[model samples]
Target: MDQLKYQMVIQWSDEDDCFLVALPDFPGSYWRTHGDTYDEAFANGKEALESLILAYESMGDNLPIPKVASSV
Candidate 1:
């Protein structure tokens, strides 16, 4: 959801030969999922985000605060 305000960054990786997705707001490494195409990568990223949110809620853990961009 837009309310979460999590950043999803998708980029092409030469080494992996696929599009890599990074959920910067989440913990762990930048790379979370990959896809042969850009769209697939995006879909995978969304799925990953949903799973993460559910996991946190089920554990009764506090979710990470979303970051906001400054106008300046």
Candidate 2:
């Protein structure tokens, strides 16, 4: 859901030749999914986040609290 404001870290990997997406809120793998372009990476990251939430719910695990950003 849009209400879940989890942090998504998108970075370009020269060696991999693609954009890597990582969900800091969710533990486990450093990189959940990736894409060839930034746009693709963003979309993939959203899908991955949804899947991760579903997986945690199905497994009866508590979802991690989303980190909030502070304004300067």
Candidate 3:
């Protein structure tokens, strides 16, 4: 299987205790881990993405549905 790449944006959340991870291309697919630091959150997010990707692949499903960018 080809290596799949997905962007995981990690941002600090003041109201929340954990690091916020947002999958820009995948809506409603965000998760947070019990982390008090940025690095911890980033690490957790990476693990989360890896698991999600594996699950999808195991089910024979396509990962992110890349959109075709329109040129002006």
Name the best candidate (by lDDT).
2
lDDT, candidate 2, at 60:
100
Q: Candidate 3 on 1-72: residue-level lDDT in tens? A: 235566667877788866787666555645534357888877787787777778888999888864445698
Estimate the Cα RMSD of every predicted model relative to the unseen true structure. Answer: 1.1, 0.8, 3.6
Q: Write the per-residue lDDT of candidate 1 for residues 1-72, one digit (tens) a residue.
A: 556788889999999999999998888887999999999999999999999999999999999987778999
Give candidate 1's TM-score. Answer: 0.91
Candidate with better TM-score, 1 vs 3: 1
* lDDT per residue as tens, model 2, 1-72: 888899999999999999999999888999999999999999999999999999999999999999899997
After superposition, which runs of candidate 2 have C-alpha atoms over 4 Å from their true positions?
none
CA lDDT, candidate 1, residue 22: 93
Model 1, position 1, has a per-residue lDDT of 58
Name the regions of candidate 1 deviating beyond 4 angstroms.
none
- RMSD in Å for candidate 2, one decimal? 0.8
Ranking by TM-score: 2, 1, 3
**Model 3 whole-model lDDT (C-alpha atoms):** 0.69
Distance from true position, residue 61, model 1, in Å? 0.6
